[model samples]
Target chain A: MFLQSDTPVQLVSSQSSSVLGEETIVLQYEAGMYYELNEMGGFIWSLLQASKGMTVGQIRQKLLDEFEVDAVVCQQELTQFLDDLLREKLIEATAPAP
Target chain B: GASPKKVYKTPRLKTLGSVK
Candidate 1:
């Protein structure tokens, strides 16, 4: 599913994560699967862990500020990452407040 | 002022399989 820029996302309750060096390891309890996130992926995961309902746009801006990547590339990559998380049931997205 | 040279890497999420 395509996540809107303003949509808020939070980690699913059935998982636990650990940050080891530059990588973040997440275990989905229900699926009994382990996900390894690289440096950039770990950075995004850390953001979500720190804040319970951060928006996609907020994440994109944080990436832009922390890295030298182009804005378009950042948005595209972030959306893809979040989409993967959503598909794996590691995270859930909420509709924007009306 | 010079900014950090780190470019955003395409975030990778590797599934390592169930631990059971």
Candidate 2:
């Protein structure tokens, strides 16, 4: 596991707001605290979680089976999400896991 | 060769600093 079980993320959902929006999510990521995702975010969230330490190629195939989203859309959205997560240090990414 | 730089998610006093 990329993250040891002891270093688990603590998710504080959007309880502060009644509606969870894109901008709200962008603002909600708290460092040292993992995010609890909403519906749409959940799909993307799960993909990244399962893809930890795996190649992006593997992530693509798994996403295809898991959601009705197109490969291109999946790639684009997932990429952006991952990029933000990386930038935020919410996840630690390796070099494609060889 | 360089250690990774740490970026502060919120530098403003209001965001996470207001945690109560």
Candidate 3:
């Protein structure tokens, strides 16, 4: 599924995560699958764990604020990361409220 | 003035196999 900039995303309830040194380890209970996320990926995961979740644009902006990266590159990398989580059912994205 | 160094590494997600 193509995710728009405003789409909201959150971690799925079935998944759990823990910090291991610089990385985050995520476990998908139903599938008994383990996924490893690098430091940047862990930061994004924490944002999604927020009660209100976060939009793709919001995440991109946060990365820009916290790191020195080109806007276009940030968006591209963020999109790919989120897409991977979505594909693995680690996260779910919702349409922005109309 | 020089800009801060770019610390951004492309975010990655890798599957580490299943518990079962």
Candidate 4:
């Protein structure tokens, strides 16, 4: 399923991350995997780290305020970016309780 | 003031080599 606005997400605690210049490097300890994120991806990583389980929509709104992009386009890109993170197990997403 | 559309470049994510 695609990540929706309300999907709550956070960085995996078992992982370690460091930033060098514009790139962010994340190491998943248990899996022994390394994932590198570019400048914009770094920005998104910071946002999620700052607020645990922040919804996808909230993240998009923050990005819209900081960057100039159409809402639709921003959402689309964010969805794909988050999906990649999920695939790598770098972040976890869950639905808010009803 | 005219605001220019921000050029959004897709962020690159790569394996960048890995360790077992």
Name the best candidate (by TM-score).
Answer: 1
State which docking tier applies to candidate 3.
medium
Off by over 4 Å in 2: A1-36, A47-52, B1-20
Model 1 has a clash total of 0
Every model: iRMSD: 1.2, 13.1, 1.5, 2.1
Cα deviation of A41, candidate 3, in Å? 0.5
Which TM-score value belongs to model 4? 0.89
Candidate 1 docking class: medium
lDDT of 4 by residue, A1-98 (tens): 56888889999987898998889998988789998899889899999889998999899998887787888888888999998888888899988646
Q: Ranking under lDDT, best-scoring first?
A: 1, 3, 4, 2
At residue B13, candidate 1 shows an lDDT of 94
Tens-place lDDT per residue, model 1, A10-96, is 999999999898889999999889999999999999899999999999999898888889999888889999999999999999988
- For residue A44, give model 4's deviation from the true position in Å: 0.4
- After superposition, the stretches of candidate 1 with alpha carbons farther than 4 Å from their true spots are B1-5
Largest DockQ belongs to which candidate?
A: 1
Tell me how many clashing residue pairs each candidate has: 0, 0, 0, 0
Each model: TM-score of chain B? 0.30, 0.24, 0.45, 0.21
Displacement of residue A54 (Cα, Å) in model 2 is 2.3
What DockQ does every candidate get? 0.79, 0.03, 0.71, 0.56
TM-score (chain A only) for the predictions, listed in order: 0.96, 0.52, 0.95, 0.94
CA-based DockQ, model 4: 0.56
Which residue pairs clash within candidate 1?
A: none
* Docking category of candidate 2: incorrect
Backbone clashes in model 4, listed as residue pairs: none
Summarize candidate 3's per-residue lDDT along A1-98 as a digit string, tens digits. 78889998888899999999999999999889999999999988888886466889998988898898999999999999999999999998998868
